[model samples]
Every structure is written in structure tokens, then in C-alpha cells.
Target: MAKYELNTKEQHFATTRLEAEAIVTEAKEDKHLIMHKIAEKHNKYGEYFLVDLTFSYNTPKEIMGVE
Candidate 1:
């Protein structure tokens, strides 16, 4: 089995790097968010690589100053 980690401030997990990349791409394109960073990482766990993503956008809540 393979595991990957994704982060957009919060964290998500994927089974493959491609899947994680897809998640970030779709969010930026479809959802119109700004992608700050996209990367792949490998740790001591072995052959599996983790995908990391960072993005940002202004939400209606932020504009409205909701708390």
C-alpha cells in the first residue's frame, strides 16, 4: 500500500502522488483559488512520495468580516 500527504493549511491524505496533484490542480482551476506551492516529498518511510500543496483565496466570509 502507498500513502501520500497533502496540505492546504489543513491536511489531507491520498494513496498516490498523482491523486494528490490532481486534487490541488482541480481546486485551483475549478475552484479559482491561488496556488502558492506544489511539491512532492519523500521521507524515511520508503519509496512512496508525499504531495504537498498550498493555496489561498478570499472567501465571502472574509470579505464580509464574519467571525
Candidate 2:
């Protein structure tokens, strides 16, 4: 199985690519996160690779300083 890493406002990991994709999609819809970057690194055989996704959550400064 392949390992998936999602680096959003927080970091998350998945055991499969589909799960990682789903997590990003859900975050996009529910949290309004933007996709910043995606990368995959393969092993020697190229049979498995680690997927990394970076998501950015853009919140206004006004919304962050106060509760």
C-alpha cells in the first residue's frame, strides 16, 4: 500500500491514495482549503510511492486574532 501525507493547516496521513484525495476534497468543501502542492516519491521498484499534499487555509486576520 502507498502512504499519503496531507499537509493542510494541519498534517494528516492516509494509507491509500484514494483516502488522501478524499481528505483533500472534503477539506476543500467543508473548510474551504486550497490545494497548494502535490508530490509523489517512488521507491526503487516504482511500485509504491509516498504522496504528499499541501493545503492552505486562508483566513482573514480579523478572524484569527479574536475568538
Candidate 3:
């Protein structure tokens, strides 16, 4: 195996994985409900890092309860 030295962005992205492309397609049809269910599942199963980062970046005000 080759050695690797990942930078910060690579490290963060490396920790995120989407298990199934189908789930993404499903979310495309019903974004609100499917994404909520996915978030809950990731939280419960301890794979919430990516979703957390995405929401934190994309919805900082909403997540942080700011105005």
C-alpha cells in the first residue's frame, strides 16, 4: 500500500460517505422528509459528521439559532 498525507479538506471529506446513490435519488423526489430521516439515522448511528458539517456550513444561522 502507498503512504498518504492528507490535508485538512481532504481529511474532512474523507470522513464523509454516502452509502447509497439511491438514497440521494429518493431525496431528490422528497427532499424535506428524506433528508430529515437521513439526518436522524446518521445521528443515531454516529455517522452524523458530514451531515453536521454540511448543515453547519449551509445553514449556520438556522443551526445556530441566529437571526
lDDT of 1 by residue, 22-57 (tens): 767666674534443444556677444344445455
Model 2 Cα lDDT, one tens digit per residue, 2-67: 333333555565556776677666666655355433345456655332334446444455345654
Score candidate 2 by lDDT.
0.51
Candidate 1's C-alpha runs over 4 A off are 1-8, 30-32, 47-67
| lDDT tens digits by residue: candidate 3, 21-58 | 34444444632332322233344546533232111122
Give me the candidate number with maximum lDDT: 1
Ranking by TM-score: 2, 1, 3
lDDT-wise, the better of 1 and 3 is 1
lDDT (C-alpha) at residue 2 in model 1 = 32
RMSD of each: 10.1, 9.7, 16.0
Candidate 3's clash total is 0
- lDDT for predicted candidate 1 compared with the true structure: 0.53
Alpha carbon deviation, residue 59, candidate 2 (Å) = 6.4
Q: List the residue pairs that clash in candidate 1.
A: none
In model 3, how large is the Cα lDDT of residue 63? 39
lDDT of each: 0.53, 0.51, 0.33
TM-score result, candidate 1: 0.40
